[model samples]
Target: MTVIAVTGHLHLTDPTVHLVRAALGRLLAGHPAAALTGVSCLAPGADALFADAVLAAGGALVAVIPSPAYRDTLDAGYTAEFDRLRHAAAEVLVLPFDTPDADAYEAANTELLRRADLLVAVWDGLPGNGRGGTAHMVAAARRAGIPVEVVWPEGAGRRPAPPA
Candidate 1:
């Protein structure tokens, strides 16, 4: 089976979500359902999109949560989707962290790389927000000798950052 993991932005523009989802679906369609497995942290944007595509493709989903508290830390608007995907996961691995912070996220991303045969990144080729972001995961996957497929569809764009 091919194990694919995803890392990406959490705040994509509305239109970008549709674009990414379609791109991911097309990508996953290349793999036979019986030989496909997807691992994701299920973060709001791209991660959730990837998970949905995996399920839609008849692939197994293994969710790696950074912490038990991670879901609680998601924005209220995304909590329901998070819960739905989490419940649908074939397996859920919760790291031993009480809080959802940078350290926990880094660890979770590490685990994702460790388990994946290939890393599917939904990055925009921009500098990441911070440690454990998409760029960091892509670098980690490369350093570990895993193949990476970046999916940033044409015309895709991120939502503008909210005022500080």
Candidate 2:
């Protein structure tokens, strides 16, 4: 079987990235793909880490940009890495049909999940405050029958976010 897609949250630091990189390496080992082909939104946290890991492992990267001109309006600090991944992506699937409002983010995330066969979530597991919504999306993916592999810091699972 061809390797399925991998999706996850994007909110990791350097050390977290190191751990996550290793986790992904272990998880992706022996997958039958000339390279990994998956969708990443290029967000700073877990998204960038996932994308970077894919490229580092000699896998192809597919960027599912949230909107047409998102790079123009993304956070200042995130621009460079966004640019790097965007340029490095083997192909880009721009969802320019909608701008990135709350509804749009949800829509984009749903689309990301729709294209995936598996999801790898790396969330802090703090309570959701309507801000970072990857946790919710992860739940949604699980409901949709996509296999989910969760990666978090040592204490994360012990403190999962409260239910909606």
Candidate 3:
């Protein structure tokens, strides 16, 4: 079985969301569903997209929750979707963290690497705003010699940050 893990931005632009969904679906179609397992942190954007694609493709979903307070940290608008994905997960691995901080996120990413045979990065090849983001996971995958499939579709763009 091939175990694939996902790491990417959580704040993708609306257009980029569709772009990524199609790209991820195509990539996932390349594998036989019976022999595939997808791991995801199930964050708002790319991660949720990947998990949905994985399920649609008839593959197993393993959710790696960063912390106990993870759901509380997300916006209320996203909680329903998060709960749906978490419920659909074949296995849910919660990291040892009290809060959903960068440290917990990084730890979850590390757990993802330890369990995955391939790392799918929905990245734009840019530096992450902070630690425990797509770039960090990609770097870690590279260092661990795991194969990485980058899924940045043409015209994909991130959402602009709101005024401070």
Per-residue lDDT of 40-101 in model 3, one digit per residue for the tens? 99899999999999999999999999998899888789999999999999999988799999
Model 1 Cα lDDT, one tens digit per residue, 63-139: 99999999888888889999899999999999999998889999999999989999999999888878888998888
- Candidate 1 accuracy as TM-score: 0.96
Q: What stretches of model 3 exceed 4 Å from their correct place? A: 162-164
The count of residue-pair clashes in candidate 1 stands at 0
The lDDT for every candidate, in the order shown, is 0.93, 0.69, 0.94
Cα RMSD to the true fold for all candidates: 1.1, 4.5, 1.2
Give lDDT tens digits, candidate 2, residues 1-164: 32334445544545766777777777666565584565778776667877887787677787877778777767688898899999999888887654666665666777778778777777655544352276777777878988877767563332232353
Candidate 3 has a TM-score of: 0.96
- Please report how far candidate 2 places residue 58 from its true position, in Å: 1.4
Of the two candidates 1 and 2, the one with more favorable lDDT, higher being better, is 1
Model 2 pairs in collision: 10-45, 10-46, 10-47, 11-45, 11-46, 35-59, 36-59
